[model samples]
Target chain A: MEILIYLTQQFINGIQLGAVYALIALGYTMVYGVLRMINFAHGDIFMLGAFISYYGITKFNLPFPILILSTSLLTAVIAILIEKIAYKPLRNAPKISLLITAVGVSLFLEYTLSLNAFFTPNYIGFPRPFEIRSYDIGMFSINNIHLIIFSVTIISLALLYLLIYKSKYGIAMRAASHDLEITRLMGIRTDNIISFTFGIGGALAGIGGLLYSMAYPQINVFMGIMPGIKSFIAAVLGGIGIIHGAVLGGFIIGISEVFVSAFLSSTYRDGVIFIILFIFLLFRPNGIFGKNIEKV
Target chain B: MRFFLELRKLIFLALFIYLIIKLVIFSGLPTDYMIQITLYSFIIVLSSLGLNVIYGFTGQFSLGHAAFYGIGAYTSAYLSKVLEIESYYGLIPVIFLAGIFTAFIAYIIGGPILRLKDDFLAIATLGFGILVRVILDNSDRISEVLGGSRGFVGINKITNLELSFFITVFFIIITKNLIDSRFGLFWRAIKNDELAASSIGVNTFIAKLIAFIYGCFLAGIAGGLYAHLYTFLHPSNFDILKSIDFLIIVIIGGMGSISGTIIAGLFWVFFIEGLRIILPSEILEYRWVLIPIILILIMMIRPYGLMVKKEGY
Candidate 1:
């Protein structure tokens, strides 16, 4: 019974971890669905959001709810601006050009933040705005932060689902994802749809970053890279173009990662994730929900 | 007229080689900073050439070229350092062994991976590169010689200007010859249209596998050269960023152009080093900031890069 409780506790931790990944992976999936580009800098945007929130908490003395709202909005605007500046002009250009630009943007974001004038490369301990409290059920203890993360993730995902499914913008987005040229010919401004996609994606990623920092509490220039890559892996595993699949993929990766570290050496955590990515790419390149289509 | 053109080209080549030799000798010693830059540039050119073949010529879009390079470096480092092979003559075989070993590994991995088209292939390779780095960082369980994250050190400093120059020239010639051969035609055909090439009876899979292995082999050779030149090995040195650096050289130099790779490699190294010398210490860190801007602007202005395509005389 004690072992069962420990395992259950680990499972909840995995879900909490997966919540953050699911949030980030949603952005990746949505953007990929519309643009067919990876947006390699998405992770850096998450890092930027966390840093922005850090300033809000430490410098401005903003409350937790206000910090979350402002950071999401700010990151959303920045991501939309990046899309307009860096990606919009290359819509008709070669795919490789867009990919390279994304990489450039990623490097620009990382190094710029690491600049002495900016966030700097040093790690800053995030000031927790909330009191620490835990509730025990049976033999397992759960933190208030983990509960908050889970609840926030579910609520945000539900809102996103409604926005994507029930709203006119969602229809336009789905149509755009299916065939951009066709949708444009059908009198939809693809440019706006693309921008909207980026906005929502960035907002979700910002929330993810905020929650992640709340859990880990350490902010640095490169904090987003590993999480970003892992979330991308999650997006790929669930299916690049499928929204719900990304969430599923996220939970699976998160649980497996936690279990691997728990049972095996912590060193193998990243290696195992990569191996899982490889396996999925080899056996099911289309992912769990994606359909195999010949891109070439 | 064609014979005269060939003769003229040969004369120019000879003159260029003679000029390089004179410069190397006139520098007084191989240890000079200028010679050091030349040697490092040669290694960059050598490795970028491998990337050019897979990404530029074959259109395989591998993002893990640095992982293969790390493999070669560690292999050579282990053989020479742990096995105590000090003689340059003995090191020659070890270098070839490193290249062969990397090629074999690429050949094995490339079989299943090369099936995926452009973007998927890229992500897979990226993951592979990350996996290599992670394993290298945590390799103490396998052997303490790897030094894990602390880095492996004390390898022989065997690389010099002369050796690097010869190897660079030799690889350039070999690659040029390969591109001019029937194999090059097949690779271009596949790059242009893989389905069409396959329909035309081209063994596209085998052809791609061969290109990947051959490219990785050259990267391995460059890694061996780099390992000896630096006389140290660190997992950090062979990360995804280093892979991106190699790709930048290939892309900025103009993919599929050998002369372009050579020029870009030299230009990139010297430009960074020159920036360090010209800028004050306070502003020197800003060079990195400028580099990404340059990369983005270059892509916007010339998406195909400087040379545009395989240039002609």
Candidate 2:
């Protein structure tokens, strides 16, 4: 019973952490869906978003909710600008070129943030308003922040679902994902849709960034690189093109990683996650929530 | 017809002599730092050649190639240090042996992961790279000889500019020949269209395996030389960032282009190191900013890289 309870608690923590991954993974899927290119820099963008929001709340003395909102917008604008400058010109270039450019952007952001005196290499401190508390139920217990991460993630995910599916922008986005040419033919401005997708994706990732700062507190400029790599795996696990698949993939990866570390040596944890990804890729390339394999 | 005919055979003969003199007789550059930079650049070129085989020729975007490099460094470094009593094949044979050993490891890991395509494969490969590093960090004996956190140390240095450069050129010629051959053609075709190539009697799987194995062998060879040159080997030596640095090289050079790889390797190594030399201490930590920005600009301008289309590849 105790083991089960322990497992359950670990599982919940996994889900909460997974939510963070899910948010990051969503950006990857969204970009991939529209452009058929992996935005390798997206992870670093999330990293920067976290720091930017940290500053907004701390140095600038902005309210918590407003900080989150502004951070997303700021991240979105930067993403849009980056797309306009770097990716847009290479629209017709070979896939390898774009992949390389993504690396370039990633490196640029990582080092740029590192250079920022305010955003020093030392860990950025966040003022946490949420009370650190815990709750124990039948076979499981979790802290207040975990609860907050869990609830906020659920709410954010729900909101994203509604926005992606219910809004007119959502319909256009889906159409664009399916067939950009036809979508453009049907009087939809795909350029705008693509930028909008980048915007929304960047905004959501910003929230993930802010939430992560609150939970973990330890961050460096290069922090986004690992999580970015991990979330990208989660995105692939969930299916690269599907939005919901990104979410499911995130949770599965997150839970599996924590539990694998809990049971096995932490050394093998990444190896195990990679093994799982490899197996899935070999057997079921579509991923947990993937509908179909989209061609590049 | 006669000139073309004679040219082909002469090219090979000249290449054969070049390899002989380059490997045996040529005493490398005079300056040690020059030798270090040259050697480092050569290794990058060699490893990038390996990467080009799997990634460029095979059309697989593998981000975990550093693991193979690490494997090569550690495997040969350990053998050289421990087996020094027997003196076993000296430094010369260990180069080829290290290549063979790393090939085996690559064969094992690359098989399952090769099935993955695009982004999923990349991240999985990244995970694999990190896994290799973490495992290296934990092992005791590997730490003792190969040096875990402290890194493998106390190896005698045999690498110099001449040795490293000649070896790099030799590897490039070999890689070029492989890419030019039917085997190379098959890899390229698979990259162009996997299913279509498969339908046309190309055993996509086998071709990928062959490219991966050979590519890994080259990487391992480079790692062996790297371990010898630096006389140090640590988990940090072959981290994901190191992999990314190589990625930056190949990308900036122009993927799959041999000359591009060579040019990019030099430009990248010297440029990064050069920036460090020129920049003040206050800005030293942030020097990476310049590289990435330059890379992004280069990609923006010449999407295929500084070179145009790759020759034969």
Candidate 3:
């Protein structure tokens, strides 16, 4: 009975954790959807966002909600600037060129974070905003903070779904994704759409980072790399460019990691994920919900 | 003309051998630091050149080459430590065996894993790297010999600048010859256009596998030398960041260009060593910060890298 309750609690935390991954995965999916290039720096940007939130809450004494909102907006602007300065010029280059730039940017961000005094050179605990503790039922338990994160994530994803599918701007964005050159020729301002996509993705990732710090509370300069790559795995696992698929992949990854770590050994968690990735690529190259392209 | 080229090669070989032996024999002008720098730079060049075959020329992004490096390093280190062998005599078989073993492992992963494109391959390889580290970290049996987290404490150190320089030169010759062959052209074609190459009856999968295996073999060779050079082998030294360090050397030096790897590898060596002199010991934690910033700037300014384009390119 105690085991059952513990499993249930772990499951809830896993779902809430998946929500955070889904947010970060959206950034990877968005950039990939448009440019077909994996922005390796997205993980570093997520890390940077957490540091920003940490500063806002501690140094500036800002409230949790206010800090998260401002940090998300700031991250959006910074992401857009990174795209323009580093990635935009080499859009026509081979994919490798752009990848190298992404690595460069990722490295640069880590260095900057290391230099900051507040962040220091080592790992430090982050500030959790709410005083909310866990609420346990007969066979399940969850923190009020976790519930808040879950609600915000669900509502945000719902709005995102509506915006992407129902709105005219969404149509334009899809058109651009299909054929950027043709879309530009047809008088659609593709750059604006690209910027907007980055903005939305960055804001989501920033919020995810903030929520993550609130949960884990231990922030370091290099904390984003592993999670960033994992979320990118989530994006790939769910089929890239499928927004809801990102959420689905995130949950699958989260739950499977918990089960694997619990059942097997915690050390084998990543090995199992990579093995699944290899197996999945063999069977379904286009991913779960991804459309296949017929080459002429 | 080809005869003249062969003659030039012979002359270079003779001079290199003479220089190394003379340094080892006399000219006692503090060769300790020089030996370390030269050996490390040589190892960097060797591995980076090999990686260029897979990444630069073949257009595959593999982040797990360092796993093979660690595998080889640990293997050679184990043999030397356990068997108490020296590099002077029977270590030849051990080095060759270790390299082949590393190649086999690389081949196994490259078969199925190379099918992944871009980020997928990157993540998978990164995972493999971590797996290597984890296994090395947790195993108590091998940990005593491999030093687990504490690292291999004492090993016979026979690596010197003379041996390193000669071995590196030998590797450069081998690589240059290999890259000039039919296999090299096939790899270059795959890099240019996989679809077209496949249409033309080029077996890209085999070619990629070959590149991966060969790259891993050279990484093993470097690792074998590195284990002895440092005299303290550990899992922590051969991490993902070390993989990135090799990648940076190749990229900075013009990937697919042999001279480029040599030059950039040397530069990387000198650059880090120079930093040690300039910076105080207290602020060494922040020293790694410069690497990333420099990497970014270089990517922006010269993505193709510092190599001059030859007529062949």
Best by lDDT: 1
Q: Which candidate would rank higher by DockQ, 2 or 3?
A: 2
User: Candidate 3 on B166-207: residue-level lDDT in tens?
Assistant: 666777777777787888888888877888999999998899
Worst 10 residues of 3 chain B by lDDT: B304-313
Against the true chain A, what TM-score does chain A of candidate 2 give? 0.93
Encode model 2's per-residue lDDT on B129-220: one tens digit a residue. 88888778875543456556666778878776556666776787678777878998898898888999999999998899999899889889
Candidate 1 Cα misplacement greater than 4 A, ranges: A292-296, B1-34, B309-313
Q: Which is superior by lDDT, 2 or 3?
A: 2
Q: How well is candidate 3 docked (DockQ)?
A: 0.45
What root-mean-square deviation over C-alphas does model 2 reach? 3.7
Model 1, chain A: how large is the TM-score?
Answer: 0.97
Query: Which portions of model 2 miss their true places by more than 4 Å?
Result: A116-118, A135-141, B1-31, B85-89, B141-144, B191-200, B274-279, B282-287, B309-313
Query: TM-score of model 3 relative to the true fold?
Result: 0.93
Question: Residue B124, candidate 3: how far off, in angstroms?
Answer: 3.2
lDDT of 1 by residue, A10-127 (tens): 8988898899999999999999999998888999889988888888988999987788889999999999999999998888877777888888999999988799998889999998
lDDT against the true structure, per candidate, is 0.87, 0.79, 0.78
Chain B superposition TM-score per model: 0.90, 0.86, 0.90
Model 3: residues with Cα > 4 Å off, grouped in runs: A116-118, A293-296, B1-14, B17-25, B141-144, B281-290, B310-313
lDDT of 3 by residue, A67-86 (tens): 87799999899889888888
Docking class of 1: medium
